[model samples]
Target: MNAEKPPGSKQALVIIGMHRSGTSATTGALRCLGVDLGNRLYKGHEGINDKGYFEHSDLADANDEALSALGSSWDDILLRQENWWKREELIPFAARIRSHIRKDFANSSIWAVKDPRVCRLLPWWLEIFDSERISPRFIFVIRSPHAVFRSLERRDGFSMEKSFLLWSLHYLEAEQWSRNFPRAFVDFDRFIEHPAQELARVEETLGISFPISVENAAPCLNQFLSRDLRHHQERESPESSPVLSLTHALHQSLLGAVDSGQPDSLEMDALWNKMESIQSGFPRALVEHIRSSGSIQGNLQITMNRLMRSWSWYTGKPVRFLERLAGRNV
Candidate 1:
């Protein structure tokens, strides 16, 4: 399915979000509606999602290493790519990935890609695809800050203070890009509560139908989604939230060393100080909603729901069954 389209073709559908954000679910939803997910994919360790995800592992790993070499972690430099917009570094990498997508999905009219790292490389994408006449629609998924921070904390072992700050920064970066692009933001909370409605929204935006069913893939989806949700809301049960003793001195040490030239770092003295600044700069109502929500519990629920939806490939026994059927077909 890799045929080149004639000029003036409708753009491809690209999904953007934080790592644990509902990127996978959104991509899977598109797949359900007839988007082709390439054969090669990346998977997470067990517990996050039982079914493996379909991200391009090679691309993501290489990008992560590149980002680190620039003196920033993926979570740290997320969406902060002036270099990309200036047509300097990282553009070539984006070009390669975009080329691969075009080559791989040549015969397909619709396809979806989910790589959290894409959040930062958007400007490069626009430079390559949009300028070169490859039109593409974007789907952005968001979860509450509380959920985002909590889930991230568990995954990275980052402190809540650091987690919250990073969560805010990540969303703000994504929001800035979405505002200037053809995109839609799917609130993780809203999507899970009404999958059909969210899927329909995506369908309407991309002008395509995604008919895949979550009913059959619920087992893997549900489990993967559940853990993400549970981990994020752990604060609700302080007893379950992993507790590590920290001294005021250590807190100060972290706050003192956080000067990586991030814009929000200068605003507040405490680690959580920059959160408000980042949230203020975000260009969406969801940011406000998340700020007011206060409780991480809601966000946790949103995470689980999105995770389940994203892990469509592993959701049901049909995947194994389909493999057998394919074997017969081949």
Candidate 2:
């Protein structure tokens, strides 16, 4: 397969999915398939993801800051506030994002950026893309809610109930926003079991080819995509909670669409609406406020630091005068 880009075609691959959903594995596979993952990557943390997380650190930090500015966090479920992206406040951050792209991927024709936060902050990135006149192809990775929850429990100490809710929120937002772009959804379970077939599907769906043969990339892939890494095995036909059932249905639907190469917009909408209805009573406003408090605390700290410094400068003369008086007495 030819890995070279067609003449004058500037494209990017943006991997959008929930955390612990095999996003890192998918990004690593893409890298093996000739996709440039930029220079500065997040080395996977020990005891969590020993295989390096193929995410850009700066981009991930920027996304966290952006979410903080919006009074949200990475774990926030109600982050998709309407028209938040169009706010004037995001302009500066957008400029920074553009700078990051230019700095990290200066010479590459086709590169990728993967941060689970991107699933929520997609509109902001889409605006940057539109203004910069760059087109992005998206690779959305999905996994069973049960497996994802199990992983989150082990990694983040999250409860299964909260994990299920977060899983639903992330995938729903990802599906809703990514519909307008060129995208392909990959099943993580299938991918781990059959890397070549899944990678080939990604290539055909996105109209790109790997730079090297699959045989060559096999060793690299094996290092990361192993059975031990897949610690959470999904139970066969196990009983699911209501939230899990809903998310599982959504997962199956997306997988079916991917296999058929056609997305069922109506079905997706119906499932999303069902989820929204069920979660209508959640304390979204309160949660948003609580999440935003982090940003407030951050800003308050900065202000307090400056105030202390200023007070020290102004009181320096008075303190020195007292010191001279005490010296004379002594």
Candidate 2: regions farther than 4 A off: 1-8, 236-242, 283-289, 292-330
Per-residue lDDT over 1-330 for candidate 1, one digit per residue giving the tens place of the 0 to 100 score: 011232446456667666776566656545555567777666555667445566765455545544443334455522242453463455565666666766777776666667776666555555556554666666767655456656676677766555544544544444445443455556676666666666666556556544344454445344444323323442332422211212122223322322221223222233233434443566767544443342243344334434544656457647767877788531
| Whole-model lDDT values for every prediction | 0.52, 0.75
Could you say which candidate leads in lDDT? 2
TM-score of 2: 0.81
Model 1 TM: 0.60
**TM-score for each predicted model, relative to the true structure:** 0.60, 0.81
- Report the C-alpha lDDT of model 2 over 206-312, residue by residue, as the tens digit: 78767765677888777767766666887544656777677777878878877887458888788788877776766868766766775775455445435534657
**Candidate that would win on TM-score:** 2
> Cα miss at 308, model 1 (Å)?
24
Pairs of residues clashing in candidate 2: 71-292
